[model samples]
Target chain A: MSAQDTVLVVGAGPAGLSAAATIASMGKKAVIVEKEDVLGGAPIISGYAKLVPSGEWAKDAIGRMVSRVEGDGNVSIHKSTKVTQVAGEAGNFTATLSNGDKLDAGAIVLGTGFTHFDSINKPEWGFGTYEDVLTTTQMEQMVGTGQIRCPSDGRVPERVAILLCVGSRDRQIGREWCSKICCTVSTNLAMEIKEISPSTDVFIYYMDIRTFGLYEDKFYWKSQEEYKTKFVKARIAEVTKSPDGRLLVKGEDTLVKRPIVIPMDLVVHAIGMDPNALNPEIAKTFGIGLEKHGFIDRAEQYTNSQGTTRKGIYVCGSATGPETIDDSIAQGQAAGSRAVADLYGQQKVAS
Target chain B: MAIHEKTLIDPDRILQHDHLVVDGVDVSGSWNTMITPRTLTDYEEHFEEIIQSYSGGENVHRCWQCGSCTNSCTMYAQNVDFNPRYWIYLIRLGLKAELMKDKDIIWQCVSCNKCTNICPKDVRPEGVMKATAHWLEDNGLTPKTLSTHFDEEFTHQCIEFGRIEDTEVMVGFFKRSGQPLVQAWIVEFGKRLTKRLPLGQLAKMGMNVVFRPKTKSWGKTGEVLAEYVKAQKEAAHHG
Candidate 1:
């Protein structure tokens, strides 16, 4: 495929990889420009133990999509390259790579996904201060390493408390939007921890379980009934350390209207999704708009959920907002088809 | 007129005209319901400290007013006015006057331990209720309610004998609380008790009241406990 037939894809996460595959399948070249050397994004960087909801090993699940994109010769992998500058119109554009390589494409897909909320912003959570305090990503890394050890003593935790909405849905921190994936991911992690160490009691403190639709039965129900992952309906106020060096999860049991302080060997903060720090630069590069909360603003969320305010530029997956892996992949494909249609306005097929 | 919804305003303080005009303003709409401006001059700056001085109210300072306590409260289920969360909020803010409005129902906490078990901040609202009721009595905002009298009578007997004869406690509590000792329920219970108990057991009960059962080595323990309690109570009220 010539440079004229290629589509520029920024970010090599699930969204970018899926978009590359979809574009490649349409007989159009996909040039994936990733800042990182590796392609699989968080799942690979954090070495996620398994994809939540499905329980598939991160390598196997994301690897399949990665392989599909890599298998196609139409996909060009630009490793450790960043799109420093972009210019031109819908059907004819040039993106200058960090390596001084210029790539010309018909359209651009800004699937530059999201950054995990830096739990350090919430000092009350003790995320970085205490050794026992771990973010959901850190916890997943520990689980992936085949040893869920406490950061304090390097011993397997006897009990763990997973707190939901650490950054999301908290007005104090100014993130009122619910990070759509944390609840299901937290519940899933609770169950996984239970499975890994049955003796390790897992407690998930949540205000509301947002395991909506299909995940209601698969993740939430199974975590509760089958795995016995204890769900406490309370948003934790703060995490303190016990005299014995264990983490103390202070929260009210909303159901019983009483304060509960649970001592835990490990406290996992299911930190919500935050827009990537590179969002402002990327938005400026594409001449697109940013949402109130800083995600790439879509032209019309109800009608065109993935279309950016800029004509040929689009965003998908967590770059727009927190989304599941499946939703990211599907939206990637949608962006691919939309780009294909936009690039070839008068024609239906690649021909 | 832009209306300010004063949810916390005193109903009696609100001056609403029935069929008259206010200085030719003809406030005929719902705007006619005018709330009297309030100047809160009764905030006890250290009131939360006093609440925390009580055993159950020790964690009251940790409360963020999530309303979980009120939602889970057994009393709140029956009477919505029985709100532990609201009282905790008032106490934290030192709105002593606002807190006093719910003084009558504060003592109705059933000591269910539900509030204690579920408090995320471990406010132990059940204990806060007990402490608050005591605080009210200590401050003389209200007289010693029946529940306080019963508690005092029970504690006084326990301290004196180190053990309470069941009948003695009942008769003592009833007497202290100023309830008729010959109530219909008590009469029925006594009749049933006599019917169920053999003569020997009944005699044992009579002997217990006469001799007054005592913990064998509880001589100085009760005295020490009573003295410590009195000191703590003094400190709680004055310190």
Candidate 2:
């Protein structure tokens, strides 16, 4: 494998696109395959400003990467295409694409990100049963549309309840792993909703408030002090529909050991993320391995987060594990450098 | 709300003793020596053997006693003492007497299958509940109210008719339970008036339940079920 060798990257999200841009910058032929008609994956669907380290807009960061990759002649992007079949050995594999086209690659990187956990599985959350109850994704769309009205009545909600950990940290539902990002995302949404509608009451039911790193003080102060969002430390037991079309949320205040039922005009389930549904298919097709929890298993945590068990194949971002945008970008760059090192037989570039 | 006064154990004093006795029973075991050993060794042994017999029951030993299953149970949503996880734990720990005390809770399951679906490790908590119910029936530990009327009536109806006739089953159930038989007719009449009778929607309810078809080989199926139970008992004894 050389600089002229083509490296195929699956997915066009931050991780895949970052890898493509990095590879092209290093003068390698990089090809990106995206299943969606447009790029940006969940971010576009979410319609939120990405949280950068410097509090900069995520679009600006993503726009820079997209320009670099698209401007480079070595990088070829294939939208509305999926890799149907992967065959051959490491360093000389063939990917049979969806359009009956085949591409030969010296190295491959899997960055097919995670899918949102289906909140309806937790039926007690009243996700599908109540029209007023929406998912975090749906809430984002509402905010994007510049109105936060109850889906049932098309009226501005006077009382809103956001339930955290709908599909995360719940052993009874079998998803014990912490989704890590939902806390900050929910807290941020709560603040935004309050800023838009100051009189609207927002209550967040959470098992625990996990605001890790620099976002910790910001999340805590904003929700607790600034926005005055009522934080209740309890896991919701059930969400029922009231005769008036409001959602009746029931849960025990763990500290008080007493049940509390609050009626709200609207409810939001901050659902977690699971490994992409295509993870198993990709693992079998590429001879990679999956963890017990179904995410692609990295070879080692410390030294090989990007590298999988198979040689010449690297995995990064949410495909390997749950991560924020900052972590995904860093891992993407590292994976690109690692793939380059594997091809060139030297670690010249600082990842 | 009023807080009731009760005898309080000194936490410091209890920590000093390696073993504690509750009502003349030894509490010392592999993990918690402070609590009384409510489970018997023989019962624990048999429960483990039965669990090991089923592929789905293999995760029974992985219970960390977190009480998450019991806390999240839909049955417990209605009844406070109907803790399925605790019952399963009792079975694992060989607390047969404690398990037998809550036999009614075993059948109270609506089979919502929510517990198994939400189990973090794919523990199949519902299967454990079913296994416990089956174990109670095999051991004859089911309460008289549950076994004498409900179980006997259901078993008799299935064995004799191959399928249960709702009206006949209700009448038989009421008669055996010392209730009046005419009550069943009143209920049936009320159901018929509301167009809720099963026989009325025979075509929609599926052919098996609507027609009440007799099993061609009822005897064979009964024999197979009996043999399976006997084999399980033998294995439990050896185990």
Candidate 3:
């Protein structure tokens, strides 16, 4: 195939894998460069428990996507590599990989995804201070292992408190946007916790239960109705230790109109998403603009939804903003189609 | 929190045609109830501040009405109309007329603190309940409730003797509320208590009731507390 027939896909997450698969299916060559040694992105890398909407294990679900791209002959995979530089215009471009490999591509699809908000920034919530306080990711790992025990000691937690919006929607932390998935994920985790240890009572403290779309009844209501997980409308102010060695979640129970300090065996922070840490460097390397929030800037959403500020360069998934894995895959496919069409359109004009 | 509750819709506004046919379609009873749209104009702009002027209602302005208070409410479980979230919404919107609709039940808060304990915004809905109930009585919209009368009697005992004389407090409550002291429930309760108690303990209780117990160190403490309470009440009312 000519250089103009190849599409360079960045990152090997759900979005990137789908993008490459879509490009290959469209009868075009796809060069996928993933910085991580392994593929499947956050879900597989982070070892997420079970995906929301579908209770399938992250490994099994995202693994299928990985195998599809890996099995495709039209796609060339480069692991532990970065696209260091992009030179030339749209429909004909050259990309330099970190592994000293050079690639000629017609268009690029960025599916770099996002970084899970680190709970250490919000010190008062006690991620680092208390051994029992864990992030949702860490809790998911425990769920993946099918072991629900307090990290402080090898004891089954009697009560687990899942605090939502730990990193998102907090103006104090400067992360004003909703992370979008945490509410559903937290509810899913709550049910998982109840399932693993039926005796353990799980309480999810949320500002607003934004299990949007179909996820509302499936995750939120199901967790409450089926699993018997309690949903509290209190955003915890602080997570402290009680005299009895149990974690203390301090907050005003707005319903009861009283400041309450509830003791828990485990406290989980439903950490939000932040723009991928490598976004600035990626934007600079790809000659793309970054939005004010630091996600890749979309040129115009109306006509070209996947088009980044730079023509022939498209952005999808959490690299643009906080997006679900399923939506990101759809966006990846959309970006792939856009890249292929733009390249073919250029060739049609040239011919 | 649900912004629009079923209770907010007045029964009068809901018109259901028993038998009707419209445009070749037969629209029957209850399926299609036409609710007249309510247009509110008499909103007190400073209603939130007015509620804030009362104790416990100070944080009434902080309510985002997430319904956590109502969801975990002890009173709401008993009566759906006892919705703290909806009342808070009305208070915030300065819907005085709408609020008056639920004035009778507002004083029925069991003080369970469930709503306050679960509220995300620290909108102490329990305190708001107490404040709202007190506001109603202070404005003469509601008569002093039996609960308020009981509270006054209990407070009177505490101030006079630095202790609660349960029998005196109950008698005082009945007197203030214009209820007969020899109620059937009180008689049944006395019979149960006598069955559970020994003769010696019963005699001691009778002696204590006859001669009201007083704390020895309560010298002038009652007067100080009474004066402080008076001043605080005056400030809260007028300030």
Candidate 4:
């Protein structure tokens, strides 16, 4: 296919890169635009530490995926560029790049991912005031350094508290939607923490530990049984600093209706995800709709996870909704196949 | 009184409390969490403005008493009862009495704009605070300590001189509020005591405050302000 028939993909994260790779393998040109100076989004920042299904290292799998996508010659990667304006009808869109360059494409796929809810938004959590209180993203960065030490004293924490549902399932704050990935991600991090520092005590405060689908057994069992991570079915009401420099967590044991106060050396806020700020910008530019939660709105849930109301405008990965890397890759391939089918049908009609 | 069927609930037999209460009836219990359904009639006049100000105020009615806003607010970092979300919920249900009950908190908003900024929907929480404050002031339910002092000071000064005299206003506020005069004029007193006052003529300052120049149109301006207030009250009634 000629370069003019190329598919424009925004974002070079897991989903965008996967879609580009899939399109290139099908002998179609894929032009990928990434706002970041380098490819790989959150995953590259603090490399994945997930438990692979094959019991292998997660870094290996991510490395392989990155190499495969980068090796493709049919894909033209443009870094530090974004689609500022998107106009024209489906099957023919003219996207104006931020650099005054324009690109014509028959189809476009959006894989712009999500951003972590700023922990400072919930200041009562004592995120900035207390050195021991850190968000999950900050914890990930510390883990990336291969050592977890209290920033205040540079000592391993004797008791670590992980508070869940920081921004999820909160109706009073108006964030009623549950950020699906927090449970599994927190559980994984808890387990890793325990394995690294066996002597350290880990307590997870949650309204309910939601481990859905195939992830249920591994996350719930491994964290609770194997690692012996204490699970408290309660919502943390307050986080304060103790006079002795320890972090104090207060919550109610809902079953007994009694308040529980626990002191810890460190507190980790398992903060949830929020829709990217650019979701609305994308919706307005492409004439696509957004759901009430600010994610790109699909025509329907079952049949149109990646399909938008406008033709030739598709969305995958967290741009559509909260999703995992595996799910994002699957959605990318699906969107790629859908674009190819549309192109092939048009060619047949023209011939 | 019930002698027809001879229905007996024996002391030795286990008695069920469910039998005492019937369907759709209020049961006497220690927990009075059952919320009374309130009518929006009292606020029906300003309902359109309130709704428009709060972006329809329909979404706020969906609050399930989750107390997320209370738990999430930074202002609550200092005061727990100062809940922005709860006030919005109360407004949605048109619980004007409850809205008036928390008059102090209605105005305590620091305007950090975080609550609305973090709202999942564009609820515009700051607007809710403004609406609640307006509702309270309209009903004359302002807090005694805070609002009364402010209103008394403003009205007294305005009536005495037809406009506010800043220095006199400060002195009157301190005297009426029963605060120490020393505390009120601590800085001014210190400047005078230290002999570090400005190198300007004291006569100019005295003329500016005590012998302040009067406007030729002062009477007309006062008449115009009174007319404006009257028009506002009439429009509010018609609305």
Per-residue lDDT over A42-112 for candidate 1, one digit per residue giving the tens place of the 0 to 100 score: 78877888897678999999988888888889898988989988888878888899999888988889889
Go through the candidates in order and give each one's DockQ.
Answer: 0.02, 0.01, 0.02, 0.01
lDDT tens per residue, model 2, B1-239 = 02122124323223324565668876545323342222121223356457545534555654534467777788998998888777666655455656666787787877787877777645577777766666666666775573468767887777666667666667678888788766767878777866864665655445645566667768667666657766886665334
lDDT of each: 0.81, 0.73, 0.86, 0.70
Q: Per candidate, chain B TM-score?
A: 0.54, 0.47, 0.55, 0.46
Query: Which portions of model 1 miss their true places by more than 4 Å?
Result: A1-4, A347-351, B1-239
Ranking of candidates on TM-score, top first = 3, 1, 2, 4
Candidate 3 lDDT over residue span A218-299, tens digit each: 8887786567566666778888998879888888655444456777899999999999998989989999999887888997
Clashing pairs in 2: A172-B118, A173-B118, A174-B118, A174-B119, A174-B120, B39-B94, B39-B95, B40-B94, B44-B94
Q: After superposition, how far is residue B165 of candidate 1 from its true place, in Å?
A: 32
Model 4 Cα lDDT, one tens digit per residue, B21-80: 436665535322232222121222234245434322323433333455556677889987
True contacts kept of 2: 0.00
Question: Would candidate 4 be rated incorrect, acceptable, medium or high by CAPRI criteria?
Answer: incorrect
On TM-score, the stronger of 1 and 3 is 3
lDDT of 2 by residue, A1-351 (tens): 342388888887888888887787787888889898866656764565535234444456666767777788988989899999888766677889999989988788877889889987998888888888898888877776667788987888887889998888878877878888888888777877887777776778888777799777577546644665666666888898767677788877564344567678899999898888889888887889999888888876576558887877888788976788778777878788777666664533223
CAPRI level of candidate 3? incorrect
Poorly placed runs, candidate 2 (over 4 Å): A1-4, A49-64, A347-351, B1-239
lDDT of 3 at B1: 23
Q: Which candidate do you rate higher for TM-score, 3 or 4?
A: 3
